[model samples]
Structure formats: structure tokens, C-alpha cells
Target: MSKRKLRVGLIGGGGIAQAVHIPGWNNLPEAEIVGVADLSEATARKAAAIAGTKEVFTDFHELLKLDLDVVDVCTPNKAHTPAVLAALESGRHVICEKPLAVTTAEVRAMGELADAKELKLMTAQHQRFTQSGVAARAWVDAGKVGEVYHARVRAMRRAWLPPSPGFIDGKLSGGGPCMDIGVHALDLCMWLMDFPTPVRVSGTAKTVFAKGHDMPNLWGEWDRERYSVEDFASGFVHFDNGATMVLEAAWMCHQPDNEELMAQLFGKQGGLAWPEATFSTATNGIFAQGTLTPTTQVPHPHWNEIAAFADCVLNDKLSPVPWTETIKVIGILEAIYASSNTGAEVAVKG
Candidate 1:
């Protein structure tokens, strides 16, 4: 740990702020929560209490002027680009939660500004830090999987609604399942396949659940009338490496066995899986489907992802999860929606 702890300014004090950000930041020895902000002063104060800080403000702009080292943004999808850009322009580093931005243009700018300022910028795709995900990626990198050819990523929830008003609005969320949850599976797929350049995409985002049919989710019932995006999405994305991925995602579907999250990597020689890090690889002349094969010399858990972000900020290291990677995912998601709307395959544009 460094002698000087990084002071953090937080924007957004909702459940994600309380449950995810607070606990995640507390685990780091190099970071400190200095100021908290939200749309409501009450919410900000509540988060301050949980974080053991008395500095609470309803305005993030005021908080940003407090000479903070890094700004942690857990706000809605729409606010990501603005908050991050302001933070970077102010000469503060930033760690934003997933879906980097609602659009590729913003993500590019975020990346560009960070580079120009020599500041650390990271997106919180914490699932990348999962023991199974990390282990699986290592296996692929070590050539244990042997010539990867297919990636199947599934993030299907029975009826899980984001529960936030902004989440269902296309203006705020960009899209539905892909931006909300599918990115996790996609990230795992990309990581496992070594981030190959996607050449073409054919996909659809169905409005099966967006109709707001009567359904119950762990997050509770969402008003269908207010629903503005797709409920299910499927894509066939071809990469420059000659490998193709089958991406499937949904917020609510009639599928029998629900998989809220997971990516299955299939290589020419063997297969690997996640949500529980395990693998099946070919050795000598035999192929195994499910076996206890140690992926690498070490294994890491969820907190490890947050630690990576903190490490990057304190050490001034560029994030392994680059904005270019995030922008590509955004481009894919946008293309998927475009393909669905026009009933034609869409090319991913930078």
C-alpha cells in the first residue's frame, strides 16, 4: 500500500453506492471516501453515514471542487460520460461502473481525455475479477483451451427489472439487456478470446418482456407501460480471428432454466465455463467436457476486480479494460439494436 491514501469523491448514493461502492472501497487500503453526492441530500447523507463521512452534498459539482484524487461514479447510464469527462477534465482520476457510456462517442472522449491528462480511467466490470472468469481467461491465454472458435455468453434473468426509472428509459440506458447485463457476458467472452476485433455483427433485441407481461423478479415488478426497450437479445458476432461468438441476453423470458449470468467458451480442443470457474480441455488425444483442471498457478475473486481499479489509480497505470474495448461493446450493442429495428445486419462502427 502507498503511504498516501487516495481521496475519493462519490457521485450517486443509491443502493449500488451503499452496497457495492462502500464495501468495495472499504476493502482497499489505498483509497478513502471523502465526499458523497446525490440528487437528494437525504440520500447523500445516508450514504455518508454508511461510509462514515459527514461531507454530503446534493450537488456533485460542489463535491468535485474538494481536491479529490479519484471520482467514483455509480450513477445512471446517461450520466456516465458527463461525470467522467468532468472528473478527468478537473485533473482527477475516475472509476465508472459498467456500460462505460451510453454511446461510443462518449467512451472515446473519456479515453482520449484520460490519455491527454495522464489520468487513470477504469470501468467497473467487476465480474472480470471473478475467480472463474480470471481462471478461464488464463486457460485461454496459456493455450490450454487450444484454438478458440466459439464463445456463448448468456445473461438471462427470469424477470429482473433494473427497478430504476432511468434504467428502462432508452434515453438513459441506451438499450435494455445488452447495456444493462449482457455486457458482463460479453466482457467475459472478449477476455477469454483475448479481445479479438469484431468484424461483423448480426443480431436482434426482442421486445418480448418489454411488453410488461405479468412477471415477478427478484427486483420486483416493473411497469410495462413505461418500458421502452427490448427484453431479449441474441447476436452472432464474427471476429477478425475467425472466431465467432453467440451472444444471448434477456431481462425476462419464458426460458425454462434461467441463467442470469454466465459465458461458455468453446475452443477447437475443449470448453470452459463460468459463475463457477471450471474447465474441460484436450490433452494428448482425449477431450474432456467437465473436469477439475487448475486454470493457472493462482485464482482471484470478485473483490480482485475492484482492487485492480484501485491499483491502477494509485500506481498511475492504464487500465487493462481500455475504453476502446468498452467502445467496441457499445458499438456492438448499438448495432444489435439497429439490426433489430431495421431487420438487417448492421456493421459495427468506431
Candidate 2:
């Protein structure tokens, strides 16, 4: 007798779902995507076809009717909360895309529901599944970078502003570069630091170049009138452990690199940088600097992330990227926007 395959349902059958997530679910022999839901019927049909399933729905609620073991949410930032809450309520484990809910309140709502239901809820932060990221994390776990005190994170793009309404519209996407790209680097940084409690944040968010025609977008033009979110944001964070961090994110900036995504951690014993996987330390009055090599290669981080989520559900293990850690990430980001609005330091809870 063969083991029954884990049936999965997909919410938001858009680019991320079709491009990486659908293929990711397909790659796992123990799991299969049974249905796909999208706002557009055509998109839902397209994603369903790719998943080799006939189940397609224009409404996610209809997809939720299926006897699915898991729900993968690839929706835009704003839609995450409702979809995740619904999936949790339906007694299904869930994996949602980054910036999980844009705010801590929404994160708590979904998180608490999942906890009550005893279902796994994971955030799809694929950067942490990369080869370099794995190597850096192992090193940090081994106390290579002991007692981290300060960190620097950046997610800057020269001129790659996504022209999509879901990205530019604050009502849909919640925030701009801070929430879109900044969340990636910030999450990785905090994860490496063992998720220190964020106490306060002071930041600035502005729409510097998206509305203007001076800086041409590399990904093409976006609607100037609908561009309500900030193109650039920066923040200073203070943690409960007396640690501090400086973060910067931008969609358009005058930089040498087309895009520079980085997270560097400074500690008392050593300093480490991610993606680059470089580390520096001094012992016995001698300087040592070297790159950490991963024992295994992760060419497809998205697939690994999908596999990790599925494995947790199948084996009854803890979620790889739990909501507790995610709330801290969102809390800092929410504080950044709050501080930006009031021009004052915002206190972060939890």
C-alpha cells in the first residue's frame, strides 16, 4: 500500500505561486497541490494547470472547502491576514509570503488562531534557506559571533520599482521598500541574533523618486498618481539586550550596484556578514578573516522553504519560521512607519 499524498491548496495564483511555489510543491512526492484560487479566473486556471489539477476557484474561500492538509498563501501583503486566518480556522497548516501581515496586530490574530488550532504557520522567508544563509546561521549558532551588539541591514535598489498596483498602492501593499525588501534583510538579521526583543525604533520613510519622472525605473514605469507608498526608508532599532541596528531600504537610489541586499552583524567576539558568508575575528593578537562554506548547496531556496514547511506539517514538528519570531520583525517595521509619521521614536511591543 502506498502512503496517501498530502493535499495542498494555493491561495493567490500569481507570479510567485506559478514561478516558484507551484513547482516547489510539485517537487515533493509526498505532497501535491490540489487546487488554486486567484482573483482572476484566468490566473487560477493557469496555476491549476501547472499544478496538474483541475480545481480552480476565483475565491479563496471556495478553495478552502477542499479537504486540504496545507494552504500556501502567495497573496499580496494586505490579503495575508484574512487568508491565513481562514486557513487556520479551517484546521489547515499555512505558509505565507514575507512581511507576513504588514502589522503586528494582524500577525497576532493569525498566530493566535493557529496556536489555538494547533496548526503550523510559517512565513516564507526564503533568504534564510540559501546556502550562504545556512552557513552563516550554523556559524552564528556555534558562537562564532558571540554577543552581537550592533548590526547593519540594507535592501537598496538603483531603479527597480515594481510598477504593479499591489506594490505601489499603500492600501494593498501596506508600505513600500521598507515592507517589501527591508523585511527580508531585517528578518535574517534578527534570526541570526536569536530574535532579540525590539524595544524602540526611529525611522524615516519618504516618496523621493517614484512620482518624479527624473529617475527612470528599471522595471518600467508605475502610475504616478497611485504611487502612495514610500520609495525609501531607514531606521534605527534598539533591542532589549542592549543591541542596536541600522537598517536602510530603497527602491530607487544612486548606488553603484543595481541592487544591494546585505545584513552584517557586529559582536564582541567577532563580526559576520550574510549572503557573503564572511566572518572576521582576532585571537592571540592575530587577525583572522575568512568565508564560511556551506556543507550543502541550496540552489533553489524557495523549494527548500516549501519542503521545510511541508515537512513540519507531515512530521508534526515545529514551524521552521514561527509567527512569534515574525511578529518581532513586523513590530520593528510597524514602528518604523509609526516613527516616520510622528517624527519621534516609536516603542515596539513584543
Candidate 3:
């Protein structure tokens, strides 16, 4: 740990902030959470109490006025862009929660602002810090999964639909499982493939069981009338490098697993699967296979993610998860939603 302590201002004192972001920052010896801001004053105060800070504000702009080195944004999907922009403008580096923005355009604007300020802006895609993800990335970087041409990504839940308005409501969430859990697997898979430019997307997003009482939710009951987002989504993507990907995301389904978050890639020379973190290949006409075990185990990936972001900001290192890479992921997802609505393949511009 460095001797200098980073002053961090946290925005959005919600579940993610309480569950991971705040705790992760607290685990860092070189970081001190100085302020917390949320839409609800009580939520802000509660988060501040946990973070060992008295500075709490309902308006994030007020929190920005404080002396801070970085802003950790755990706001909803739609709020990410504005919060990140404000943080950058306040002369602070930023680490924002996943689905950095609902659209590629918003992501582009935020990325541009960060670039102009020469600030470290990282998306909190903590899954990349997991043991399996680390090993998988290392294997891909070693050319073990040579020339990935296709992938299968899944983020499905049997019946665990989130019982929160922020997740079920389209206005707040921007999208359902596709933007929530699906983004996790999709981003990792795309990163593994080195983010090939997406050319087109064909997809479907439907409210199969969320708006009715057919399936019982594992996470308690939610307001069906407020459920404006999709309960299930599937998409196919074509990339510029002649690569392709299939993605599935669902909050409720007839699945054996409570949840299955996975990404499997197929390359010309080999194939690989995540969470499993295993690879298969053939050499000299002899088949070979192996599973990669990570050198280190990160009990809390969010902590490692926060530490990485702070290190980048404090040491002038490149952002571990740059917005440039994130835009491509979001672009594919946005195209998927558009295609679903239009009943035709949608072109991906970003």
C-alpha cells in the first residue's frame, strides 16, 4: 500500500454501493471514503456511516465540491453518464459500475470527457478480476485460444428475478437482464475476443413470465405492472473480423441452475470456456486440453477492481477497463435491443 491516502467521494448509496463499492474501498489501506451522495438523504447517511464518514449529501454535485481524488459511481444505468461526466469535470478520476452507459453515444461522450481531462476512468466490471476470468484472459493473451471466431455467452436465472424497481423498471434500469447480468458475461467474452467491431445484431427481448403469475420468483414478488423491461433476451452478433457471437440473458426461465453466468469462445486453433476456465486444442494431430488455475484468488473482486482503479489514478497508469473497450460492448447490446424492436438486423455504428 502507498503512503498517500486517496480521498474518494461515492455516489449512489444503494445496494451495490453498500454491498461492494463501499466495502471494497474500505478494504484498501490507501483509500479513504470522504463523502457519500445519494438521491435519498437517509440512504446517503446510512452509507456514510458505514464508510466512516459524516459528509453526506443528497445531491452528488455537492459531494463533488469536497476535496476528492476520485468518484466511485454505483448509480443506476441511466445515471452513469451524467455522474461520470460531473466527476471528470470536478477534476477527479472515476470508477463507475457496469453498463457504464445505456447507449454507446453516452459512453462515447463520457470517454471523450475523460480523455480531454487525462483522467483515469474505469468501469467496475469486477468479474474480470475473478480467478477464472484472470486465467482465461491470460490464456487468451498467450495465444492459446488462437483467433477467436465465435462465442456463446449466457447469463440466466431459473427464477431469481430481482425484486427491485430499479431493475424491473425500464426507465431506471434501461434494460433488464441483458443490461444487468448479461453485460457481465458479454463484456468478458468480448474482451477475450479483443473487442472485434460488431457489424450487425439480431435479437429478441420479451416479457415472458415477469408480467404474469406463471412463475414464482426466488427473490420475492415484484410489482408486475412496474415491470416494463424484458424478462428474457437473446441475440446474435456479427463482427467485422468475420467473427460471430450468440448471447442469452434471462431473469426467469425453466433452468436447473439458479444462475448460470458463462462465456465460451471458439477459435480456429482451440476453444475455451469461462467460469470453467478450461481450454481445448490440437497440436501435430494430437488432441490436448487443460484447465487454467489462477495464481491468486481474489475473495472480493470488487476490492481488487477498486484498488486497480486507485492505482491507475495515483500512478498515472492506463485504466484497467477503459471506456474505449466498453463502448464496443454497449454498442452490441444497444444494437440487439434495436433489432428486437424493429424485427430486423440492426447495424452497429460504434
Candidate 4:
């Protein structure tokens, strides 16, 4: 007889669950798409039909009553806490999408629960699965880029605001690009540096173009009065080991050139970059710096994280994106928001 299949319950049948999670999991024979739940019954049914999922529920709480091995959270940021808690409480593994939770406190609570239960609470930071990202981190860990001291991550956009209402809402998204796009950069940097305890964070958030009053996003404008968050944000994070990172992100900026997404790391030996770029190093007498040059592209699928998660869940293997490291990334993110709020250096608490 075949070993037991890992039955999964999916939450949020919108774009992410349909495009990323379901498709990736379907490729794995040991995993089965058992059920799906969403706020919108129509969308949920559409996804369920396409994925060949049998049980569908509009109420996520009801879906939690099923016998599931894994709970894949593709819901909004605010809903992540309750959904994950329910899954972990039910003795089911959890895989939450990025921005793990909207607040550091929420993430800490989830981590605490997962810890007490001795369950794997994996956060899907899909950027970690990219070939370029994989190569960069592996090279750094192998001491190829020795003693990385400084770095820069830039995520630029011409105003491609997401479609979901919760995306622009501060209470839901946590912050603008600093959380959406910048979170990937933060994870890459911290993971490369092995998540050194951050000492300080200084930052600024601007409502330059797409404020709550004027909602002219790249896709289109929503109700202006309902817009309740930032459009662009930038910050500098300082780690306890004296390493620093300059981070920049935005939905809209005044600059003329638009940068896709770039991460650069500099160390004692050499530096590495992705998306057709170069980062070189110099370890000479006194002065040293790095250079950016065009390099051959490293192709990777956007859905690699989902496939990896499926494999891990099916085989009962440990996830690559540990919940603790995800917490560290969220801690820095919380600090950045706090720094923006109080106009003071936010101390990264645990």
C-alpha cells in the first residue's frame, strides 16, 4: 500500500493560492489538495474546481475542523494570526505566506505556540528559493564572500500597487514596500548574515504619490478616502555585529529610472549580485569597495518555494524557511515601522 498522503487545507483561493500554492502542490504525488476556504465563495469554488479539490468552505474556521496535515495560509496579513493559530492548535503544520504576520507581537505569539507544540510553522518567503538567491547565500556561507560588512537592497516600482484592499491598508500590510518588497531583501540580508541580533533601526516613510487621499496606483485608483497607508519607505538597519544595510523601497518614487529588484553583499573576499548584475570586492592595503557589472542570468521559477514546501510537507522534512529566522526578519521590519513612527532609533527586541 502507498504511504499516507499529506492532506492539505488551503485558505484564500485568490491569486496566490491558485497561481502559486495549488499548482506547485499538484506536481507532488504524495500530497493531495483536500479542501479550500475563502471569503469569496465564488472565487473559492473556481480555485477548488480547477485544483480538483472536493471540500470547499467559505468559513475558514469550519475548514479548520477537518483532518488536515498542513494548513497553507494564503490569506491577508491580518488574518494570518488566527488561521495559523487554529492550525497549530489543531496539531496541523502551518505554511504562511510572507509578511508572516502584520505585527512582531503576532509573530512572537505564533512562534511561541509553534514552539510549545513542537510543530513546524514555516513562513513562505518565496524569494529565498530563487536560483540567484540560493547561489548568493550558498557562496556567502562557504566563505566565498568573506566577512560581509555592508550591503544595499533596492526594490523600485513606478506605482504598481497591488489590487487587494488590505494591501494598502496599514493595519493589514504592516507597511508599504518596506514590508512587501523590502521583506525579501531583509530576509536575504539577515539570512546571509545568519540573523545577527539587530542593534538599531532608523527609517522614514513617505506618502508622496499614493496617499489615503489620492489613490492613483499603477493598476488603477481605488477610493481615495479609504486609502490608509504609505506609498514609499526607506530605512537603515544596524546589526549588533556592526554590519549595516541601506534599504530602499516604494510603489512610486520621484526618480526617473525604475529598478526591478537588486541585492548586493560585500565582504572580505568578494561580493555577489542577482538579476544580471555584478558585485565585486577589493581587500587591499586600506581602502576597499565593490563594483557592479553585467553577469549571466540565473533563471529560477517564482513558484519554487511552493514546490519545496510541498515536498517538505509530504515527506515530513524540515522546512528551509525556519519560523525563528522568519521572526528575526519580522523583528527588523517591526523596528523599521517603529522607527518611522516615533522618529527615533527603534531597538530590535528579540
Pick the TM-score winner: 2
lDDT of 3 by residue, 153-210 (tens): 9999999998888888899889999999999999999989998998899999999999
| Clashing pairs in model 3, backbone N/Cα/C closer than 3 A | none
- Locate the minimum summed-lDDT window of 10 residues in model 4: 291-300
TM-score (C-alpha, index-matched) for candidate 1: 0.93
Clashes of 1: 0
Task: Give a tens-digit lDDT track for model 2, residues 1-350.
Answer: 99999899999999899999999999999999999999999999999999999999999999999999999999889999989999999999999999899989999999999999999999999999999889999999899899999999999999999999989999999999999999999999999999999999999999999989999888998899999999999999999999999999999999989999999999998999988999999999999999997868898999999999999999999999999999999999999999999999999955
- Can you rank all candidates by lDDT, best first? 2, 3, 1, 4
* lDDT (Cα, 0-100) at 92 in candidate 1: 93
> What's model 4's lDDT at 229?
68
TM-score of each: 0.93, 0.99, 0.98, 0.90
Q: What is the C-alpha lDDT of each candidate?
A: 0.80, 0.95, 0.92, 0.76
- Per-residue lDDT of 1-350 in model 1, one digit per residue for the tens? 64878898999888777887877777777788999989889989999888778999887888998979989898888888888999999999888888888677788899999999988888888777765666676677777677778888889887776867778877777778888899888887787777787878899987875665467776876767777878789988888889888888888887676555988788776777776666776677876656445454324343566677788877767785878788877777777777888888878766
Candidate 2: list runs displaced more than 4 Å. Answer: none
Model 4 lDDT per residue over 50-156, tens place: 77977889999898888888888988787889889988999888889888886777888988898798777788887777666766666666676777788787777
Clash count, one per candidate? 0, 0, 0, 0
